[model samples]
Target: MRRDKDSKAKADRHALLAAAALQDHLARRLRMPGGPAVQPSLEPGAPMTLAQHLNLIPRPPPLLSEDQWSEVHLRSRLRQDSANECVICKEEFQTGAQVLLSCSHTFHRHCLASFERYSRAKTCPLCRAAQYQKRPITDGQDLFRVKCATRIQAAWRGHAARRAYRELRRHNPPKDERLRKKWAAERLQEENDRLLSKMEDEVGDLDSLFAELDASVAKSREVCDAALRPLAARLQQGLLREAEAEAASGRAAGRLALVESDTVAPAVACSGQQHLALQLGRAGLGVSAGLGAVAGAGAAGAAGSGGGEGPAGRPASAAAVDWDAVVARARARGTQDCPICLGHISRRGNEGIAWLSCTHCFHIDCIMAFEAFELASGGTPCCPVCRSGYRRRCFT
Candidate 1:
């Protein structure tokens, strides 16, 4: 019985191996026709998948928001007038929509539609005022007020003239022609004097508006600086101290800590002893409002005189700066050679030269050479201390 079971097991194992070989032969036959080959049909510029095609084409810009579109339309109408010609299309204005500007220039409504659509800031074709609304540097209403006042005076004169004509007709009832003409001339002169007085008052109002605008912009910077000074000092003491310490370890030690010890260090001074502070508290008092200080510019007008021009009038604060001494000290403190020349300016050979107030001084011959080079480039030839652009009379 044991011999018979062993024979059956060996027969079952041989049958299983034969079946496996048959399956492998069938798989090989199926794969043999293709054998790892792949075919491709896509040509150049052919449409890809939906995602690829969408990515290949450039996307248009985002459309303007509803509020922005409305603003553009309003601004366009405000800037152009109904009767003016469009600069772009050179067309006449139409009734349903005429573009009008704040400057009183007018244009055809449709001429600027595309410009308003795509441009970030569409300007009036004539005056170049941008589409967005801006606060007037001076009162805008004052201009219209002046116009209205002039028109009122004109209307009053016209009415008075007609009354004078009627009165002459009533009294004389068609007398000699010379008498009627003489009466008309006398009435016109009387009307002119009254209109002139009204016009002068309107002019005075406009002047006051301009004065206020100047005062606002003039005081803004000073107020901002004064408010910021304390905060700036705190930041410099805390956040900037580490950076300053690191810089001092390097070559910049001489240029640090010039400020009043409590505030920021001055740029020109290296140490506390070298700092210079000059206070001019009288500047704002009795100041002139003009661009440059005019001693008493608006004395006749209602606008109060502006503050003095102050230290700003000086060229880069160099009028008060002692450049020659600063350069000598900087050279003495410097371990490196001068930035302009490779040679050490601290040494006797180069030390004889004095720097100008512009902080660009060099040897006399060096200035001449620099001037020649500047002339060749067609740039202003200024002194090295203040970089004051002056012509060099002699060439090296």
Candidate 2:
């Protein structure tokens, strides 16, 4: 009978604890006056916080520092109204008032300043929305200064890179991998030596040849000058005479104009048409003289002994690439397949078009693949089909 009682007591204790837990859960689901719903305790015997009991506790967001808040206040202070009014206190400007405008609504600077200091809140006190001022990046003199600084930094970096390259070149010698470069350099040096010697020998020969040629040219020039000097002198004399005649004629016209003006006034110019005709004729003569001088200068330039008559530097015509011939050669070399698709060529018309200088052509996808491959190889692209030095226009 005693064992039976003990077992029954233990079962009653467990039943009581289960009942307590159930009561706590039920209390959480039910709301209480002046407070949130209660929550069941995580540890049965532990003390519970009010939030834990109410299940209404929220995770806090990040907090801003006082300095950041001060900056926000400063930005807000920039938008002051003409009539300064305190938004929070609703006071007329009895003292110095700073207005703050955010989201098309104005606020008193002191109101925002107080909230910023005490509340640690980024939201507006009025609407509970995020506070922001119209703080656009200024395109002022400082911006130009910043841009100039960036360019100067870039130039400095370039100069440093070049200096580094030169330093490395000066300090480092050849490695095993650079044997080919060393050999090329040695070979180039020998070639340069030979070329120098050959040039010296040729220079001596050229000097003699040029001396003879110079003498012949000088003699020919002297003969030509002797023959043409008389003609040039006569032409120069004729030009001077023409110029003198023009000056005399202009002076005569000027005199005539003065006489005619003295004879008539603008109000009584009924018979001044003859004088106007003479003035027009003189103006025509002046124009003719200018044209004549221009023509004479052109003729003199052409006839001068200097070789300025020779052609100036003109670009050579680009050599045309024979697409048909290139296609034929590619076909002969058995490279007539699309490299990417590995599809056989159907016909040449518009199936693929080649770049002007290259032997390869392909579908658009193949060209893009070739471009990627070329980028990987870190050099100019080879032909996609035959690995020749060729490229083509790619249009999808």
Candidate 3:
């Protein structure tokens, strides 16, 4: 009987050990990373494990409950003011068409219904107040709400973006327009002053240039007067000699006319003597005038030579000489063209003939025209062929 009891105890102990070993093995397999999946199939009378029972229990719904929605709806209606606009739709409040949250935020009924169904969290969109309790939401009503909310939210977002942009523009800082204008005026004034200064400098330079030119002209006149003094003295001596020779010639002509009066008839002799006297008188006058002019020119030349006053004046005979006649006489010797007009000298008339001291001849009209052109072009009248300076009277 004791052996029978010992055998029964051993059996019970072995069974306990085996059960413990099986439990240990199952726990190890479950904890392993790559362990094969153990899917136990339960028989009709088998009791479920804790994990299986937990898995079988139903999960709470993801959306807001009917009671919570109804409470939200009731609150929204009570707080709905005609003056207030829906936050989601941005439309004026409709008496029973809006939802007011426990957090004092209001939205359109359709907007709130959609938020509750599609929102990841069961909280107020504005205040973030959580919906703790839940109830079933009907599919038909939720579907309609989601569609309406989608359209409203899109419009609201666009309106918000535009409003924000407008606010930013209105609050922007003003530009310093007055400062910019002041700077522009200052720059203009500075530029004007700079130009004025430059013009003043140019004016001063021109004044100095004119002063120098006047001084140079005065000095050149003195030099010319000094150089002409010797020539004037020679001209005076030549004029005195010519006057003596003319007086002697007049005496000889009167004697010859007297000798001829005896041989010819009394009427013819009287006429010849009268003619001879007239000719002598004219010759004497010419000689006297020429002497007077030479004396005056010599005196002026001598005075200017000492004081460096001005250029010497030409002798009256020199000034009165018919240069055109001399040129015509010279042209008769050779067929020469006028340098200015580039045409052969015309013997028919003296209208266009001009003679220069340098022996160069030109058409009177051409030289006069050229002189006027030269003066207009800021140049002195000079010989066009030789570029030599000549007294302007030479052309006359």
Point out where model 3 deviates above 4 Å: 1-175, 250-396
lDDT of 1 by residue, 266-343 (tens): 222111211111111123211111111110111101011112333422232212345446556656755344344434
Which structure among the candidates has the greatest lDDT?
3
Question: What is candidate 1's CA lDDT for residue 13?
Answer: 88
Better of 1 and 3 by TM-score: 3
- Candidates' C-alpha lDDT: 0.41, 0.45, 0.50
Which tens-of-lDDT digit does each residue in 1-396 have in candidate 3? Answer: 999999999999977866665554455436656543453333222344333444432223344455767776566447643245666667655344544454446666687788788886668777776653322223323444666799999999999999998676445533678866665676679799999999999999999998998888679646754554455345435545654565566753542322222212221111222333344345643333322233222222222223322233222322333555645665675747776545566643644455543345666545544553454344555567756443222212
Worst 10 residues of 3 by lDDT: 261-270
Say which prediction, candidate 1 or candidate 2, comes out ahead on lDDT.
2
TM-score of 2: 0.19
Superposed by TM-score, candidate 1 places the C-alpha of residue 186 at a distance from the truth, in angstroms, of: 1.8
Off by over 4 Å in 2: 1-144, 177-396
Q: How many Å off is the CA of 268 in candidate 2?
A: 88
Off by over 4 Å in 1: 1-178, 218-223, 236-244, 253-396
- Global CA lDDT of candidate 1, please? 0.41
Ranking by TM-score: 3, 1, 2
